[model samples]
Target: MSISVVLLGEQESMVRQIESYQGELIVTRVCSEIAEAVAACLTAGAEVLLIADAQQVPLMEQVDELLSQGTAVVYLLDGSAAISPMPEVLQLPADIAMSDLEQRITATVRSLKLPEGSPERDDRETADLEPRDKGRIVSFWSAPGSPGRSTVALNFAVEAAAAGRSVVLLDADTYAASISIQLGLMDESASVAQICRIMDSGSADISRLNAACSLVQVGDTTIRVGTGIPRSSRWPEVRPSALRRATLAFKDHYDLVVLDVAPHIALDEQLSFDTQAPQRNAVTVEMLGCSDDIFMVVQSDSVGIPRALRAIDELEESHADLQPKIIFNRVSVSRSGRSPKRRLIEAWDRFGPMHDVVGFLPNDSAVCSASVLAGSPLLEIAPRSSLRMEIRSLAGIKSSNLPKKRVSRRFSKSA
Candidate 1:
């Protein structure tokens, strides 16, 4: 069977050359723009899309969309322009001889036809690659108000690292990039933004990605930190696709990847006049969707509980498979009366989602304040604090990093 193909914005001369060529590839449509070409490809069930460089440059930002639609995306590069090849997209010289073009296209199509994870496909891609394990991605998400998301994420990563696991904490909160400030890294350059930009250029690798992060030694263990945008206005630079790509790449290097994402998870961008417009909350949504595990940090207060429950409903509707493990922050008797933990558990059992609460982080204002002021982890200041112990438990550190309980000796009775 002839391989169906669509041509977008090709010169008439090139079109004539292709038309006169003898190959199994058959052109189904010629489009002036990418949108029309994509629609034509989808409607006609075209197996391949060949976009010329002149047309591809203007819509380069939308290239991710083109490569993602289950059709083979190829960029015909003319002498007038140069383009990089992504892992999935093919880049061929526009002035290639028909025979060579036919050979390359046939080979690419055959490869694309192979089933994912088949021995043939795996050998072709990974023959030279060594075996490696993918890291677990955990995202700390919360409602609009400050619910200790960053605090938990930072500590969780540190505790995991303290347990001898390789970890990287990514501050993905585009709205409020506070991890950098909290960690006291005064660098003006944003590490996460730089990493995303590198991914967008199709040049991201383990080495390049590691160079973009801040490697800090927490206790005896070291954990990498990918700081967020220096300014909130720069959120657009961290495109959703690029961030996703970067996070996936992180899996190859770290054992545990922690994401501290923004509170907003709404996908209201579709309501805009321009459907292709950049989404404000897309970063958060993408992180949540990509996370292997999501920890919903709900503040222990009147306003926070209601907001969290409502947010739960929204998340369920949007992300159908998402069942976040709830972690109530600031569990205090001041707010929930005596037996705060029991009350919070009962309330969640009554009104919250089906999953039981994962853990509760106790409110310790003095330790929190001191750690923030000192630009250090809470465990560093108060090693035996209840809050630190709880976080350690949440991180699955069975052996306590906290000091052994002190036993008091009284001289009273004999004396």
Candidate 2:
């Protein structure tokens, strides 16, 4: 009863097989090659793609592209006399024999069909192919004292930019106004206060905000740094709305936006009692809530695990949707202290399903000292440090991997 189509291989025999089942078979277009077949299939609005045995390799290369276009594939293998890789072909979930493939193809078509008279589907049908212009917000935060959240954020942004992605590093830690000083870019003018004020007034747009941001060029990478306000009283101006607007502007202009958030809420009078302003805990909540991904930094020690656990609990309570990846910083393999990995495993056994542990970095004093003194990222000051390599691996910024692209459909109305 459903319309079926075949491409490129013994079309007459395929049509005969479809007619044998008393089903409507339409070979609206035919081509000698895979590319032409794909184009024909797209133009014909074919729901099921029937690729013969010889055309599998070329078809596989375009799997993602085809899937993005909302077409499901059904590979039709040759019925051979004992000398082919039928097992391998069958292993693929999409491939199936023509004799038994009709029902499966019909089901796939039905599943992909848009609901009749559905507004959502109609909106998606008319939506643009380009992804919604928004910057990817990645936040770094840890428990009390020092967990190197700023260092991780700074270096990660640098590494991401070095790998050829436009990046912006934001210092959202209101309690500590030291990023500008730490990065050696400190000056009376290197402040985010004015930008926050303008954004709060609703007069600042993305272009204007970008122009106000400071540009820091390292090697071939360029990064925009948002220095924190000098006084904690100015946090009201740096509320979530302001931060969100700033990052939205950043995303429009940059590939990645990284936020270095303060570990705890600032209890200054301006933020504590202002009813109109964001609550004291708002910044932490906003950062964790908006981040596409979060990195939880922790020291590898007895005290550190308990502290990390508390932070996790707080994060779960405030931002239930956030699933942070834990990175055990300052890990030592020698039996000099408690094993960081063992401690992490114990935590995982109890709360493993809640959080993901991406990787661990060893305690390298040289790297830390170099970062502090030079006011530069670990990769630039101490490229040979084991910590640097670990960070690179965790961030997936290696040159061997293909650069990540913003999948257009990821932002579509259908999603």
Best by lDDT: 1
Colliding pairs, model 1: none
lDDT of 2 at 274: 43
Per-residue lDDT for 207-259 in model 2, tens only? 55665667776554567777787676666557555565566557667778888
Q: How much is the lDDT of residue 300 in candidate 1?
A: 87
**Per-residue alpha-carbon lDDT of candidate 1 for residues 172-288, written as tens digits (9 for 90 to 100):** 998888887777777768888888878776675678788888887666667888989878778888888788878977877789999999988887777975656677699998888
For model 1, the stretches where C-alpha displacement exceeds 4 angstroms are 1-3, 7-25, 29-47, 50-60, 68-70, 74-131, 273-275, 401-415
What's the TM for model 1?
0.78
* TM-scores for candidates 1 onward, in order: 0.78, 0.60
Candidate with best TM-score: 1
The 10 consecutive residues of candidate 2 with the worst lDDT sum are 406-415
Which pairs clash (backbone N, Cα, C closer than 3 Å) in model 2? 135-251
Alpha carbon lDDT at 224, candidate 1: 86
Scored by Cα lDDT, where does model 1 land? Answer: 0.79
